[model samples]
Target: EKEVNSMIGRNPDFARRVAIDFSDNLASAKMLIPIPDDFPIMAGEILRVNTGLDIHLDANRRPVVALVGVSLMGVPIPNAWLGNMK
Candidate 1:
């Protein structure tokens, strides 16, 4: 989830790019994300999308529950992102 934190970093605009409402139950399930025909896609592909409550104390010493996780939406695209990719 470090990648997610880097993208969001408590920024509103960055956070909006990810879908936080998604259920945790759906995160682990393998889903097919159709992409361009030129690229060959093997069946039963998996993407690591997630959602969670990051509960911790801020600089002000107040409890904060921040929603954090990667929400890479599944859809037709040129390529799928892998964790090792830069």
Candidate 2:
């Protein structure tokens, strides 16, 4: 079974309200968000959305996590696009 990090402060990119549901158990997950307000907007509209977060444990007693990392969000209005269109 895999488990998420309990130390919230350790990974500051996760949201405290977030929780990851794995098979039988639920693991605590947080997004250490750097720019909270802009995240939703910057992530592009055509980009893939993360359904959930998962943590993988290694045999060496190390933990690896996978998260939905996107560079863009939502489509800008036609008027807004015009502003950038030169």
Candidate 3:
């Protein structure tokens, strides 16, 4: 996080335009966030997770998470997995 923060320090307008949604097509992470059995996991809900990142691009180019390996309960789902998830 320190590395990215450093870059933003010099530029004040960096935060003005966050093209977070632009990279929706390219998702480096596809995780299944844990939730209650009764609770529903919508596409929007999953992407809005506060798991620190957003999977966005500030300094790291093209989504920082490249690990296709799913982990414990894992991260929130990416846009590509919507059709696959029944």
Candidate 4:
């Protein structure tokens, strides 16, 4: 977590860009985030999207696991898994 915070501090522009991209994608209902090969797990943890795992087949017919439905900007939104359960 500390490392990721440091990285964010060092690369504010990249972080801001990512936040904007995440917001845009969310607004468009495109929730599948393409995990970068070099993305840090700690960073993902910081974003709080480290849970929702889904299996998808890649172009080579290989199974790939990825996180889905997790927020990017830490917005206070309802859980995507559980619909309005007032």
lDDT measured at residue 71 in model 2 versus the true structure, 0 to 100: 21
Model 1 clash pairs? none
lDDT of the structure predicted as candidate 4: 0.44
The whole-model C-alpha lDDT of candidate 1 against the native structure comes to 0.44
Report the C-alpha lDDT of model 2 over 11-50, residue by residue, as the tens digit.
Answer: 6554253444455222332223334444666443233222
Summarize candidate 3's per-residue lDDT along 15-72 as a digit string, tens digits: 3322222145343322234355566654333232222222445574754543332223
**How high is the lDDT of residue 67 in model 3?**
31
Residue 34 of candidate 2: its Cα lDDT?
Answer: 36
Give the TM-scores of the predictions, in the order they appear: 0.23, 0.25, 0.23, 0.23
- In model 4, how large is the Cα lDDT of residue 58? 78
Residue 45 lDDT, candidate 2, scale 0-100 = 29
Model 4: worst 10 consecutive residues (lDDT sum): 21-30
A best-first ranking of the candidates according to their TM-score comes to 2, 4, 1, 3
State the lDDT of candidate 1 residue by residue for 6-83, as single tens digits: 555588764544443334322222222445555566335434344445566779999765443334454323223433
Candidate structures ordered by lDDT, highest first: 1, 4, 2, 3
Clashes of each: 0, 15, 0, 0
- Model 4: C-alpha RMSD to truth? 14.7
Give the top-scoring candidate (lDDT). Answer: 1
* Candidate 4 to truth, TM: 0.23
